[model samples]
Target: MRITENLIFSTVLQLLEERPVSKITVTDIVRRCQINRNTFYYHFAGMEDLVQHLLQAKTKEFLGLKRRFRRPVTFLFYMMLVASKYKTVVLNLYHSDMRGALEATIESICHHYTHLYMASLQKMNLSDTDRELLIRYWKTIASGIFLDWLKHDMEYDMPHAIKRICFLMAGNKDLSSFDQLKN
Candidate 1:
């Protein structure tokens, strides 16, 4: 966590705003970071190596959204925060050959969500297949909704939006069961 490493990472992300990843070089990072080649090599071997570190860090922060919270709205709010932080990077990765980056982010989000879903299912005594089915179903729907929401800037009250997402995975059960939740 050297300050210089953060500076280099931020600078690399910034440069990505105007060019493709393949076009970016270690010199560009060092130049933007106002550092020397040795400094860059001290913190990172090269652009590819630095990029992997950056991607993992960003994905880790995104997955950290799974902390204790009573409602799904908090996750949605976190999603908005994420979109705001890396709007251009997200849009670029979403459509660029960097599909692995986008997929990694989605998989982490889905994994955290699956944890929540599995906990609730455990309370209900769901079968393994049922739990997996629930996770798989929500993962697909939530991924698409997240992509659309980020792409279109869909606006809805947080509570209402969370309710809608719940209904999406209700699985023939009445989502009204959760409506009594404290807001």
Candidate 2:
């Protein structure tokens, strides 16, 4: 699909605020876009497909956050803000009674970090044990963050709270490969 698919998806999400996805048919999307039904189907199979595509794209954007480890940075705050930006959509995805789309999104983000940690280990000259330790730590940290965001009304700023919580995640690891995280 062309870049306009992105615009169309964004519009769909905006429209979702006014109505649920199930009720918003492809014809509605075409009408809103001033395009044809073929154009809508050309981009997505249906509203469900459109929702998945938008969630994946938006998650990519959300995870591009920079968490401060060298200095005190509000990783948690920024993270929460990003999540809250899609508050309605996320809540709907979780509670819409369709499937586990919301849970899938959160789990995907968690696993993404595991891969990130493993890749960093591959690039570092650390011992196998140290690398494994970091990976385990990160997995736990990611899970905790996910649960924390879901609970507590998800009102806390993740990045801001991360400044204080980063210490809890701190370790006596060798920073010889700090460039990995920094980059």
Candidate 3:
């Protein structure tokens, strides 16, 4: 069942590379996968569901890879690497109405890592609201950078961009105040 599902997914990705998602249908996916509509329906309800599942699978893959990195910097490095690898697919989804789902998944990932990074900073003391605010703050920054990169067709070097972000954060002395989130 998983293999069949993967086949459908891979087919969708391949088709996506060649055409817009709005034009891809379950019939197209099934025909390419060499499976009948029943098989595709068995795994996913429809194109939208398949797309959602694919995005989720990608997010899980990213999260799994990120777990190996203890530092937020390295986590971000891997994150950008994954994004760069899937730049085209990401851009496709970003431009589509499915953008909300992709953005939500990215925000969830950013929130998770931001929480980890804040917790790792033993000196930092943040209230519940402050922590939420910080998470939202970083999520916006990370999502904005990624979206901007996607909007520009990823013309820039992502790794360098990540390094630049790290440099800015390290050099911003005033940002230290963020270590202690006030009311």
| Candidate number of the best TM-score | 3
Q: Which ten residues in a row have the lowest lDDT in candidate 1?
A: 174-183
- What's model 2's lDDT at 101? 70
In angstroms, the error of model 2 at 124 is 9.3
Residues 1-183 of candidate 2: C-alpha lDDT, one tens digit per residue: 666797688788877776666667788888888888887888888888887888788778766753333211223344456667777665555556533676677656655656554664554687878766766655566657766667655666666566554444454255434423432
- Candidate number that wins on TM-score, 1 or 3: 3
lDDT, candidate 3, residue 116? 74
* Model 1 clashing-pair count: 0
Of the pair 2 and 3, which is ahead by TM-score? 3
The TM-score between candidate 1 and the true structure equals 0.67
Score every model by TM-score. Answer: 0.67, 0.64, 0.80
**Model 3 regions more than 4 Å off:** 66-73, 165-183
On a 0 to 100 scale, what is the lDDT of residue 85 in model 1?
68
Score each candidate by Cα lDDT: 0.66, 0.63, 0.74
The positional error of residue 15 in candidate 2, measured at the CA in angstroms, is: 1.9
lDDT of 1: 0.66
Ranking of all predicted structures according to TM-score, beginning with the best and ending with the worst: 3, 1, 2
